[model samples]
Target: MKLSKGLLADLRLQPELQVPDAALLALPEKVLQFGTGVLLRGLPDFFIDKANKQGLFNGRVVVIKSTSKGDTGGFEKQDNLYTQCIRGIDGGRKVSEDIINASISRVLTATTQWEEVLSCATSKDMQLVISNTTEVGIAYVEESIHNNPPASYPGKLLAFLYRRYQHFNGSEESGMVIVPAELIVDNGTLLKATILQLAAYNQLPTDFITWLEQHNYFCNSLVDSIIPGAANIDTGYEDELLIMTEVYRLWAIETDSPRVKEVLSFAGADAGVVLAPDINVFRELKLRLLNGAHTLSCGLAHLAGIDTVKAAMANDSMAAYIEGVMLHEIVTAITDKHIRHDAAVRFAVAVLDRFRNPYIEHKWVSICANYTSKLKARVVPALLQYQQHTDHVPALMALGFAAHLLFMKSPAADDPFAAYYADLWTQHPAETVAEKSLSDSNVWGTNLNTAVPGLTKTVTNMLLALQREGVNAYLERVAAEIIIS
Candidate 1:
């Protein structure tokens, strides 16, 4: 048997599986979602379905498939039903749950069903707009919304807003609480700007533009969860759309308006959904702690023959490096007033638990894309901050940096920094690699050698050590020292 609306009847008998109530399926469509991907399903849709079960947010979602690529047949065959297998460690405990999500009422292809997509604008219940169209989807593209469907996501979205303005005669209550889950820094702000740019480019009416600015609330949000493709666990019935996610979920939306809070009532269902007047604190914490640690540790972990994050955590040396760099190095370096050290400590402990999730196969290589740039963005600032406050060199971070330099020797020729690093390696001997690369101001913005006085020596020593002792042996020695300290 395949998982669908019909499967719910029998699934109710299985106490372990969380099956939705029949009444939840008949709720009115209140949210217009813009993506048909797993991250959207495992996070936002999961939250909505969970909320519906608790009667907090009694509404369904109408998804817009903006792109014509890929088959939408899976959704149609399963009646928009899927399973969310939340498996991972949560605050020093193991957690595993299977939930059937029935939040999506239907999936409409925007390219083919633009009229139907725009028609939802007339519904009073449609007060929320959610999207996860990746970072590129929110870009400005000059096009007309009248060509059956607009060529770009911003264009299509503008057409829908215009339709809503026309239907409600530009009423304030008809506005939407727009929250985008793209990984960019200011997703919602950038999206709204792109829409307004498109509106002006298309010569949209002045009143419509004013209504767009005043009525709609574009909320900048940051989402933290690892949806690693399909779930590995088996349900009694096959589910084509099943997704596996970690237990640590965070969807921090920036908003202060009472109306926005009320409209996003589903946030009440889970502690993971945090709504605040300013979410920069959350962003800084995530960037410096979670992402910063990942950037610094990924290359080292990968070079040490550890394939996944779980494997690295299982190894004592790799585990020590992870914890040391995060709690000891990265946490202290973050000087944001909004972030307390205890809070940073707590977040780091939870992050360790997440990293130790055996079910998640988060490969180190996958995190290695844009390796040099990631270091510059996530780690370089922290490194600079740490150097200013302390004279002692950050040993673990230097080792990680050394690992990155060594790993870059094998990059494809087309990578932006590949030729630069290749030339450095080709001209200088292994001993001078650190000094040569660290002194270059073009790639890393500042000359790392003079800026962080002792970094070059520390990094150079570790880079040479890695070449001589290999990562495995060197890691054991480093771990022994960390444990002793």
Candidate 2:
């Protein structure tokens, strides 16, 4: 008997990987990914992995972590390769699969090796740029300039594009299509605007702007995939990069041209990324129905003393509370009639199932991040929408917001849920929940408490109940008065 010392030998599913060594180790870099986080690794790499398996793209990807806090040393240590694991129902059976991603050739972090990053940017083979630096990660800092050693994401992008423009003497053929997977409204357009701002601030040549406008492709897209990051890389899953995720994936792109199809074909993602004229419609629908449910669930479940979604759903009363929040308060609030109602319901149910996936250990603390901001993006629209259709207050939704306000008022951690509200109420003393709501315009984009009749009273009452009886007990009172008939 003999033992192989190869790092990948012990991996349970390594034998299933069919990545050719030539494709895995040495292929022309056609993509420069700006962020090497879970989304790109899971979604885009899944596409590339499929494409390679189908013999569509033998091309390689060069991943660059475009932030000071992010480092690719771990990825590089694994030879710029990793695994993507998907777990969910497939054909009504619970199935899981592990994929060895061979699309990546190298990893570079801007802080440590800006030269390497810039060099990849200058390379003629690099044709596409993908990024998911999160919603807050893509903002422009006016002070950022080209003179800095390592710049902001847009600044770094600008430097890269300038190099590419100069590399081939401003040839239109050298220009690349950039698709950023940041979950912003019109992310590509916003990204290009920032890059153009950087160009103007740096006072780059007018031709550069023209080149950017004429040659480059900045396509807006919506990407959805639940990718749970590694608990610990050192977990004894040797040769296995544990990226737990749901089977669901979406990439809605706004581009009419054949370029997307061509690139998708070239990258082996022809099956995954969908091209449509109105990606925004789908984006809004998903954000409202899917993301909305997650936010409301957190507030409602937390008030019931339910920590994990699975635990929350196990309680029939809490589970019904979530459903009522979605169907009555949330879904009823959406103004757009075109959003598939049946699909939305199914999606909500699917999200619940995902939340209950026994193998996945999702902490409320993680999903509970950005709770205040999420309420605006996720829950409030439904609130406004419901009011528009029917002239009555959504009491359950009001109760959820009340839970959020009380949760904010209480001692809470700095996760997304508590941070903004904590900063708002704690920093500036307000006498009542309504006063807090009225003061923080950022939460609702306006004083919605005044606009919606009886909202403040409802929230105030709910807040009082929570304070007097504690969270779970208060929720029982709410269920008695609001949920239960």
* Predicted structure with the largest lDDT when compared to the true one: 1
Q: Return the TM-score for candidate 1, rounded to 2 decimals.
A: 0.97
Off by over 4 Å in 2: 1-26, 67-71, 89-93, 109-116, 119-124, 134-136, 139-150, 232-237, 266-272, 335-338, 365-373, 409-450, 454-485
TM values, all candidates? 0.97, 0.80
How well is each residue in 196-270 modelled by candidate 2, as lDDT tens digits? 987888888999899998989898988987777663433334543457667777777788767665665643345
- In terms of TM-score, the best-performing candidate is 1
The true-versus-predicted C-alpha distance at residue 438 of model 2, in Å, is 7.1
- What pairs collide in candidate 1? none
- Model 2 lDDT, residue 330, Cα: 62
lDDT of 2: 0.71
Candidate 1 ranges with C-alpha deviation above 4 Å: 411-415
